[model samples]
Target: MIYFDNGSTSFPKAPGVGEAMANLLATSAFNINRGGYAGAYRVADMVLDTRELVCQLLDWDDPKNVAFSGNITQSLNMLLKGYLKKGDHVVVSSLEHNAVMRPLNQLAELGVSFDAARAEVDGRLPIERVEALIRPETKMVVLTHASNVCGTVLPIEEAAALCRARGLHFVIDAAQTAGVLPLSMKKLGASAIAFTGHKGLLGPQGIGGMLISDDFAKELEPLISGGTGSVSDTEFMPAFLPDRFESGTMNLPGVAGLNAALQYVLKTGTAAIYEAEMALSGRFLAGARALPGVRIVGVDGLEGRVSTVSLDFTPAGLDNAAVAFRLDSEHGVMTRCGMHCAPRAHKTLGTFPQGTVRFAFGHTNTAEEVDICLAALTGMIKGS
Candidate 1:
C-alpha cells in the first residue's frame, strides 16, 4: 500500500527500526540496573545511549533530563496531572489534540481553569492571539507543534517564549513535528516536550519520550509512581531527573528501536526529509485546489507546517469512510479520513460536525504516488 498516514504513525519505519527491536529482544533481554552482571549493565548502557542521542537531537545540555514514556498521551497526562494542583490555571489552544484537551477538560471539573487560544478559520493560531490569552494565573502553556489533521505548524517557539517571559511552564506536544522539523528544546523555550516516536520519529509503538528542561525536571512531580531501576532502597521515588518520572520496567526493546530510527533521521538529514515531504504535500495541495469538488484546509502555503494536509469532499455528498474505502481499494493510496481525534481543531477550522479527509505524507511517498492519488481523486469527484 502507498501509505500517506504518517501523521498518525509512520508506517514501514526506517530501515533499522524493526531489526533493532528484534535484535534487542533476542540478545539483550536483561532488566536495566537490576543485576550487576554484564548482561544487565549492557542493557542499561543502551538505554543511556538512547537518552544521550535524544539530548543531542534536541540540543539539550543534559541527557539525564529526558524521560522515556509510553507515548505523548501518557506523557501529557503525567505532566498535566502531576504538576497542576487543584487550582492551577492553564493556557491551551483550540488547535490542540485530544491528548492535551481531554486531561485539561477533566481538570476543569476539579477547579483548574483554562484559556484556549482561538485559531483562524484556516487553522492558523496567530502568535498575538495566543499571547493575549496568557493570564496572570496561567501556570502552564500547552500546545501542539503542528496540527495532526491539517499540518499547520504553530509558532511553538513564540508560544514557549510567551510562557518563559511570563514565568509560566511551557509544554509542547511534538507528535507530528519531532523528526520532520528543526526543533531545539532550548531554542524553543519549552520546559517539557511530549513526543510520539511512532510518528515523525519513525520508531515503534509503545515507545515514546519527553525531553524535559532541567528546571522543569526538578519541579515536576512523578505522576506514575512505581519502581524505578534506581533508588530501590526507599519507597519514595528517587529525586533524580529521569528516574523520578520513569517507573516500572522500561520498554527497553522499544527504546532500542527508537534509537535506531532516530539514527536513520540523523544520517538521512531532517532538512532533506522535510523538503521532500513538503514538496509532495505541495503537489497534492496545488492539484487538489485545482479540482472541482476538492477543498483544501489550512493556509494557502505550506509554510509553518509539516507534511499533513486535510481536504473536504463532503460538499460533494461523499461520506469520509466511503472515500477512504474507495481510495484503499480502487487506488493503492492510503490516507486517514476522520475527525482525527482533534474535534476542537475541526471546530476551530469550521470542519466540525463533518470531518475532512486527511492526506499525510511521509519520506517514502513518491511523485508517482501523488499523481496516482490525484488521478483517483479527480475520477472520484467526477463520478460522484
Candidate 2:
C-alpha cells in the first residue's frame, strides 16, 4: 500500500525498531524503576538511553528531566494539569490539536481563562499575536510545534522568548515535529515540550515522553499520583523529576523500540529528514496544483512546515472519507481523512466539518510513491 496516514501514526518504522522491541520482549522485558534485580536495572538502562536521545535531539541539557508517558496527550495533560490551576490565564495557538484544547476546556470550568492567538490559513501562528495575548495573569503558553493538519511550523523560539520575557511558562506540543524538525529546548528557553513517540519519532504507539526545565520541574505538580518506585513507603507522591509525573508500570518494550527509533533519527539527522520530506511534500503540492478540482493545503515554502500534506476534492462531491476509502480499496493508497482529531485546526484553515484528505509523508517515502499518489488521484478524477 502507498501509505500516507503518517500524521496519525508513522508507518514503515525504522529498521531496528522492531528488532529492538522483539529482542527485549523475547528475552527480558521488566517494569522499570520497580524491580531491584540486575535484569530490571539493565531494562531501565534502555529507558535512559531513549531519554538521552530525546535530549540530544531537542538540545536539552540534562536527560534526567525527561519523563516517559503514553503519548503527547498524556504528556500534555501532565504539563497542563501540573502547571495551571484555578484562575490562571493560558495562551494557546489557534492551530492546537484536541489534546491541548480538551484539557484547557475542562480546566476552564475551574475559573481558568484562555486566549487564542490567531493562526494564518497557511497554518503559521503569529509570534507577535501570541506575545500580545500575554497578560500579567497569563501563566502559560501552549502551542503546537507544527500543525498536523497543514504541516505549518510555528515560531517556537520567538514565542519562547516572549514567554521568558513575560515570565510565563512556554510549552510546546511536538507531536508532528519531534523527529522531523530541528529543536533546541535550551536555546529556545522552553519550559516544557511534549512529544509522541509513534509519529515522527517512529516508535511504537504506547510510548511517549515530556522534557521540562529544572525550575518547571520544581514547580510542576504531579498529575498522575501513585507509587513512583522512589519513597515506596510513603503514601505521598515523590517530589522528583521523572518520579513526579510518571506513575504506574512503564511500557518497557515499547521504549526499547523507541530507543532504536531515536537512534535511527539521530544517525540520519532531522535536517536530512526534513529536507527529504519537504521535497516529497513539494512534489505532492506541485502535482495537486496541476489537477482540476484538487484543493491543496499548506503549499507554503518548505521553510515553515513539516512532512504532512492535505488536499481536498469536494467539488467532485466525493467527501474526504469517500476519497480515502477509494484510495485504500482500489488504488492501494492508504491515507487519513476527516478532521483528524483537530477540528479547530481544520476550522482555522477553513476545512472543518467536511475535512480534507491527508497524505502525510515520511522519511521512507520515495519519488515513486509520490508518482503513485498523483497517478491514483488523477485516476480517481478520471473515473468520476
Candidate 3:
C-alpha cells in the first residue's frame, strides 16, 4: 500500500522506534523519578537524554526548558490557556488547525479574544496583514509554520520579527513543519514551539512537547498540578522548568520511541528528508497538473511549501470523499480528505464546503508511488 497520509501520522516509523519501546516494556518498564532502584535511575536518565535530544533537534540551549505532554494539542492548550488573561488579546494566522482554534475559542468565552490575519486565496499570509491586526491589548501572536490542508509555508520569521519589535510574545505550531523543515527556536525568535512526535518526527503516537524560552516559561502558569516527584515537602508545584508543567506519571514508552526516532532524524538529517519528499511531491504535482478537471489547490508550483499537496475534484463533478475512497479501495493509495481539522484554512483557500483531497508525501514514499497515484487519478477522470 502507498501511504500518502504523513500529515496525519507517519507510517513505517523510524528504524528501531518499535524496538526501543518494546525493549523498555519487556525489560525495565520502571517509572522514572519515583523509584530509587538502579533500573529506575537508568530509565530516568534516558528521559533526560531524550529532553536533551529534543533541544539538539530544535537548536535550543537548555534541556530544562523542554517539557513533554500527551501531544502537541495538549502542549498548545497548556501554553494558550496558561498564559492568556481575561483582558488579553492574541493574533493568529487563518491557516491554524483546530489544535490552535479550539483552545482559543474556549478562551474567547472567558473574554480572551483573538484576531485572524487573513491569508491570500493561495494560503499565504502577508506579513503586513499580521502587523495590521496587532493592537495595544494584543499580547501574543501564534502562527502555524505551514498549512495542514494546503501546505503553504507562512512568513513566520517576518511575523516573528514584527512581534519582537512590538514586544509581543511569539509562538509557533509546528505540527506540519517540525521534523520536515529545518527549524531553530533561537533563530526564529519564538517564545515557544509545540510539536508532535507521530508526524514528521517518525515516532509513536501519544507523545509530543514544547521548547519554551525562559521568560515565556515564567509568564505561563501550569495547567495541571500534582506530584512532580520533586519538592515533595511542599503542597505547591515545583518552580523549576519542566517540573513546573509535568505532573503525575509520564508516558515513558512513548518517550522511548521518540528517543529512537530523534536519533534517526538527526543521523539522516532533515535536509535529506526534505529533498526526498519534495522530489515525490514535485513528481506528483507535475503529472497531476496535466490531468483534466484536476484543480490544484494552494501554490501551483513547488515553491514556498512542504511535501503536502491538495487537489479539488469538484471541477470534475466528483465528490472529494468519493475520490479518496476510490484511491484507497481500488489503488491502495492512502490519503486524507476533507477539512483536515482546519476549517479556517479551507475557508481561507476558497475550498470551504467541498474541501479537498490531501496527498502528504514523506521520505519513505518513492517516485514510483507518485506515478501510480497519478495514473489512478487519470483513470478516475477518464472513467467519469
Candidate 4:
C-alpha cells in the first residue's frame, strides 16, 4: 500500500524498533526503579540512556527533567493541568490540534481561560497577532510547532521570544515537527516541549515525553500522585524531576522501541529527512496544481511547511471522504480524511465541516509513490 498518512502515525517505523521491543520482551523486560536485581538495573540504565537521547535530540541539557507518558496528549495534560491554576490565562494559536484545544477547553470550564491568536487563511499565525493576545494575566503561551491538518509550520521561535521578553512561560507542542524538523530547546527558550513517538519520531505508539526547563518543572504540579518507585517509603510523590511527574510503572517496552527509533533518527539527521520528504511533497503539489478543479489547501508551496498536503476536491464535485475511500480501496493510496481532530484549525483554514483529503509524506515514501498518487488523482478527476 502507498501510505500517505504519516501525519497521523508513521508506518514501517524506524529500523530495529520492532526488534528492540521484541528483544526486550524476550530477554529482560524488568521494571525499572522498583526491581532491585541486575536485570532491573540494566533496564533502568537503558531508560536513562533513552532520556539522555531525548535531551540530545532536543538540545536540552538536563536528562533528569525529561518525563515520559503514554503519549503527547497525556504529557500536555500533565503540563497544562498541573501548571495552570484557576486565575491563569494562556495564549495559543488557532491551528492547535485537539491535543492542545481539548485540555485548554477543560481548563476554561474550571475558571482558567485562553485566547487563540488568529491564523491566516493559509494557516500562518503571525507573530504580531500572537503578541496582541498576551494579557497581563497570561501565564503561558502554547503553540504547536506545525499544523497537523495543513502542515503549516508556525512561528514558534518568534512566539518564544515574545514569551521570554514578557516573562511568560513558553510551551511548545512539537507533535508534528519533532523528528522532521531541527528543534533546539536552548535556541527557542521554550519552557517545555511535548512530543509523541508515533508521529515524526518513527517510534512505536504509547511512548511520548516532555523536555522541561528546571524553573518550569519546579512550578508545575504533578497531576497524578502515586509511587514513583524511588520514594516508596512515603505516600507523597518524590519531589524530583522525573519522579515528580512520572507515577506508576512506565512503558518500558515502548521506551525500548523509542530508543532504537531515536538512534536511527539521530543517525539519519533531520535535515536529510526534511529534504527527502519535502521533495516528495513538492512533486505532488506541482502535479496537483495542474489538475482541473483541484484546490490545494494551505501555503500551496514548499515554504514554511512540512510534507503534509491537503486537497479540496469540492470544485470537482467530489466528496472528500469518497476521494479518500477511492484512493485507498481502488488506488492503494492511503490518506486521512476529515477534521483531523482540529476543528479550530479547519475553521482557520476555512475547511470546516467539509474537511480536505490529507496526504502526509514520510521519509520512507518515494518519487514513484508520489507519481502513482498523482496518476490516481488524475484518473479520479477524469472519471476514468
| Candidate 1: 10-residue stretch with minimal lDDT | 291-300
lDDT of candidate 2 over 1-384, digit per residue (tens) = 788889999998977999999999988977777888998899988888888999999998688899999898999988988778888999999888999999999999988899989898888777888888888789999989888898888889888888898888899999999998888887888898898999998988999989988899888888889877888889998887788788888888889999999999999998898888889988888888887887777645566888788887886656788888988998889999988888888888888788999889987899899999898888878875
lDDT of 4 by residue, 206-238 (tens): 999999998998899999888888968888878
Q: Candidate 3, residues 24-110: lDDT per residue as tens digits?
A: 999999998799899999999989999998998899888999999999999999999999999999999999999999999999999
Worst 10 residues of 3 by lDDT: 177-186
lDDT of each: 0.86, 0.87, 0.93, 0.93
Q: Which runs of model 2 end up more than 4 angstroms from their true locations? A: none
For model 3, the stretches where C-alpha displacement exceeds 4 angstroms are: none
Q: What TM-score goes with each of the models?
A: 0.98, 0.97, 0.99, 0.99
- Name every residue pair that clashes in candidate 2: none
RMSD of each: 1.1, 1.3, 0.8, 0.7
User: Which segments of model 4 are wrong by more than 4 Å?
Assistant: none
Please report the TM-score between candidate 3 and the true structure: 0.99
